[model samples]
Target: MSDVQVRGARLEDEAAIREIADQEMAAQEALDPRFGFRPDASGRYSVYLRERIRDLDSVVFVAEVGGAVVGVAIGTIRKQESLFELRRFGYISDLMVKPAARRLGVGRALYDRLLTWFRGLGVRVARMHVAARSDEARAFWKSVGAEPWLTESWVDVPAADGPPDPAGSEAKPAPKRAAGGYAGDLPDDDPSPAGMADASDDDTDTDDDTDTDAGDEATAGEPTSTRGADE
Candidate 1:
């Protein structure tokens, strides 16, 4: 391999970085089915990198060999708020090196440059998330003195009977509709006369009747209110 140079990324390096990212993503997904590496059909990854390059808190670095980029690292400085303290930390969002560049110290060079940038920003704590099945990534992190603190898990739910919705698993309960057809618990001033009457009657009945009657009414109206809020 030619001399490897690691430095901050620039706009002209966009294409090279994107290609390396795609290559690494494909290789990771091949290694672990749970990676769920979706191809960037819309060029969103490049756009994201471009945006990050211009962000004050973000740092992007690339490693070049023989005048060609072979590795990349993207990171950011984040303000972390906790019960006991507020502090700034560095987050490694991505780190990738070409297959031919592995075991050649390219990844280490990129990480060291990123760490330097973080230190310049006065950040002491750095963190990154690695896939459980990615042994290579875990080993690299450990080599850099990083320790795991959390584990993440995912579940894939199939569509019941129609086309798959990308957000199906995150579907929320529908909001309840008010008597006035309003979706939320909005102010009563805008309610229709009939809705107001119904609300008033319900309130009065709840105050005067058995608790069972109030519970039943609440159960009957719950769905409508939920659906309304969702809308």
Candidate 2:
């Protein structure tokens, strides 16, 4: 095992984190065309990380080996609907470890730090989204005691034409649902460039330790890109 040190993220770490995030995003996009980056994603992600580092309800952690950061994890507190049994839950937004650092415990160290912070905030259950097609991701989460809480479905919505089919004059057929799962869930801040409607993620968490898969698997051999639900 490699000697890994985990600590809270500082402002100076934004560039490194963004670089890893970019690589992860590109890799996941390759897995599923639906995953994409926004205009100036680097700058935008840097800004987003900076804000997360300072936010009281959010936490960012970094894992270092030989004095260089090789892994990162991000999480935030979320309020559930009043009707839910748990009033608030912990949402992992991003988790990543460099490819070279896989299996060295770097990702797990970073994750443990985030969990510590979440527990400090009184969060009882931690939740996240994983890429649907990544067998690696699913296996990793299973090793860590996280089961599939739900499956998210996706579909394409075609543009409407001619005033809703003239109020029932030959009603149009329903749009076809898109096949396959998401590349992964996107970070809240990493939306497509302006003028593009946000593609809402069916899953809720993001992680990328394996690079393409998100969720707990990112902590082992993978790194979730975007929110790939690994966060």
lDDT of each: 0.48, 0.54
TM-score of each model, paired residue for residue:
0.65, 0.72
> Model 2 segments beyond 4 Å from truth?
159-223, 226-231
The ten-residue window of minimal lDDT in model 2 covers 194-203
Candidate 1 lDDT over 63-140, as tens digits, reads 887888977767666664343263555655566666666666666666667777877878666554454444455445
Q: Top TM-score: which candidate number? A: 2
Q: Name the lDDT of candidate 2.
A: 0.54
Best by lDDT: 2
Regions more than 4 Å wrong, model 1: 39-42, 82-86, 156-231
